[model samples]
Target: MIDTKELIDSGDLELYVCGALPANRAQEIAQISKQHPEVLEEIISIENAYQRLAAGLAPDHNDETYAKLEAIIGAKNKVVKSPSSWSPYIGWAAAGLLLIASGYFYNANNETNEEIVQIEQQKEFLETENIEIESINSQYASTLQVLSDPETVKVNLAGQAGFESSNAVAFYNNEKNVTYIDIQGLPEVPENMVYQLWSLTLDPLTPTSLGTLPIEKESYNELLRIDNAYDTQAFGITLEEAGGADAPTLERLYTLGVIDKG
Candidate 1:
């Protein structure tokens, strides 16, 4: 029930990538990413970005530099007896002050770099979200146009004998040779079975298959578009095996509707 898009937009994924998220929260994200491919893809993209950033900013150093750095650190750690002169003491104090200032500026610079990375991530997310929104809006507009067309015929499919509660609606446009079915009221399909549509010819009692409905539960309420150029007198939906049947299974019929020629 978690909204993946909202989670991605919440900036938690970026924190997760940076290892800044709490252990429990990080594990939750990991589990969700397994269930949702888009989330996983985003996580990978963020990691790649960080890798590229690190590669670009990392200082070039070899074993010799590391050895030199270790020696310097060892030298600093050696006990130094207090000198009689005040001049040396003043010089040591000045060096300590300079070190503190350098540490402060280095921390500030790191904070600024982190902020830049976050801003870039936000910009990318926004652009992606905007494109998805535009694509969805365009689809809605097209669906509205098809439903509003005067040539489109609306057919209501009532529940069959055993399926008293199942219902669905279909918008068929003969001129456009397209059909969209709204099956929001249909019951959840059983496992290993699929809902198949049939375009019927009453005169000869013939049924032409119009393909199968998607098995996704999330898509049940959405309008399912099917190509139907057949001269159909009635429409029927039936539960069939996974790959669907060569013809409608009368016993498994869930909903039925007849078109009015008059």
Candidate 2:
């Protein structure tokens, strides 16, 4: 079976949606999409995202202004002849001057249009970049607030045997019933596997799954928020199959931590 996660992360789906992939490659993607429903879903998502962005960024055009531009570009210059003895020379001279002026203005207008297009493109690019920066900054600010809050409980998960260097932190908010796990110290997860968080109860050694970590570039080292209302006394992270297992795999456990009651 093809690794759908790997294919999605490879960015081929985005290229396919943008119609940037070559014919053969696009055909291959189409064939694969039939075999893998997830790939087809990703392609649709990319197309929807692009459509939303285009709708938000598209400039409005005025019909009157458009018509004026068409008129200016399509109108032909005419030089009327004077009904006098020197009509021939005067008409020729006037026509020559008119032609020269028209050519100059036409070239200047085209240059101006090109400049306007370039400026608009640059402005759009900068706006997109600014939005991304603001989003990242907002996330960082939120995470910092949670970390600094007095009521938030911070648990440190130490690496397990054979994975002594790996570590992760969980910020638990009792009031909000939310837990944000910071996996910055953890190594990159293997493509075929995923990292799953578990909330543990010490009395009977019960474990509750908290879903699998997302396998995206932006998700790496980022604070992942999980909804947790469980009365967890301990937390553990384990490496599991792509879709995650119903229960924690004991042997594949990477990190474990016990909440301090004192």
Candidate 3:
């Protein structure tokens, strides 16, 4: 079985069908095939396949190519006095026709390639649009869930002494332990400055830096998600340097609010 498979893979079968195999190798294969039915069957299949292929691609030179050239030559010989003069004209006409066909084929191929490139670009655009739609749907689902929760704590941070009109609201979920901030009431943040959030403890007056609020993002419902603190006594927003400060600047406090447990 191994020998038969090797013979088939090594192209010995094709050589055998074409009568190109040496007599000694051919005799050895004949003996091996008599002992193995599979080998004989493989050789038969290869021969049949080659025969069919040859038949399908058989040349039609007699009727198509040779016949046309013969007729043209006969006409030139009978009508023209000098063979050289008429022959050159016939050759030039054939060359001209061939050049025109080549040009048409080249242009058609380029147009096909352009259409394929356009289709691929449109496919990529559609995929990007679909991803954006999925992201929008996911954001809306999250915002709706947060808003509908009854146990959610909503705290309005009023403007501090100096910044009387600038304000914002923070929504904290007790069970999920997450917080969302609404920045619509806050003023525009300066390029070099950012707003920092704090979770404060009134007794002894301690503040833990929650993180800085992003100036740029508010999802579906104009709500920007932020950090959460479980035992927070109050929440505050202050103008700080790029990254944020360790402690809130007393004078730069923008909004302050005490969380009412009741």
Candidate 4:
């Protein structure tokens, strides 16, 4: 009700009980506490705490000793502590010690919170790095499987008529109907042009488009997989307009390799 916890934590309740709050503010708190159950409980709790502190700290008030001290002090040249003089010093000392201890704990708590935040950030960063490394390892394991399989056919596609310097290797798994093309040996395609692969049937000399190659390529050494299951007599690549052509552009054929079905 009206955030009793907030009011208590704000030290307003303590100030009210100690009479440290101004008269108008204290009266306002009293009025609010009368209307709110939680606020009333909190005010009672603060009053109880104040009573306990006051009981422990209140100086022993002995009227007979104070009367004797007053009599001694009245005789101008006598030494006597009137209790009032020493009580103020004791209260100030206690307050100073409490302030120092509170300051130390406040600084320690802030530093501990900062360290916890820093540790959490480091944990997140390490977890992200570990995930990336695991992903890379899984990729390497799959690549090894493809390279190690005897059924995996490695076809070397050499440079064609005009492009004598370019070459690429095609790894095909007929059982899986998958092909991983290694295009590292091939040069970069010109802007607005793309490399297209074809599954060719030499008897009919038909060239069926497999797909367009990625222009902004990854590391050339990495193989790019394609899902193709054609009974290809030959694998050929051609440079075509960016999105690739419906048929192979023979004039721009860059590489060709025949699969000897012996």
**TM-score of each predicted structure versus truth:** 0.62, 0.63, 0.56, 0.60
User: Positional deviation of 144 in candidate 4, in angstroms?
Assistant: 2.4
Q: Is candidate 1 or candidate 4 better by TM-score?
A: 1
Model 3 misplaced stretches (Cα beyond 4 Å): 1-98, 215-222, 260-262
Against the unseen true structure, what C-alpha lDDT does each candidate score?
0.84, 0.82, 0.77, 0.79
Model 2 CA lDDT for position 67: 57
> How many clashes does each candidate structure show, in the order listed?
0, 0, 0, 0
| Candidate 3 lDDT, 1-262, residue by residue in tens | 2477787789887898888999988966765675478889998998899999999999754545655676777732221122222333445777775776676566666666766776777799999999999998998789778867986788889999999987778887767777787776677788989999898889878998889888673421267776574667788999998999998998999998888889
lDDT of 1 at 59: 88
Per-residue error for 66 in candidate 4, Å, reads 68
Superposition error at 119 for model 3 (Å): 2.1
User: Candidate 4, residue 102: CA error in Å?
Assistant: 2.9
Local error of candidate 3 at 68, Å? 50
- Those runs of model 2 whose alpha carbons end farther than 4 Å from true positions after fitting are 1-92
Cα lDDT tens digits for candidate 1, 53-122: 9999988867677657767787333222332333334457787757765765666666667667767777
As a whole number from 0 to 100, the lDDT of residue 174 in candidate 1 is: 90
Error of 3 at 251 (Å): 1.5
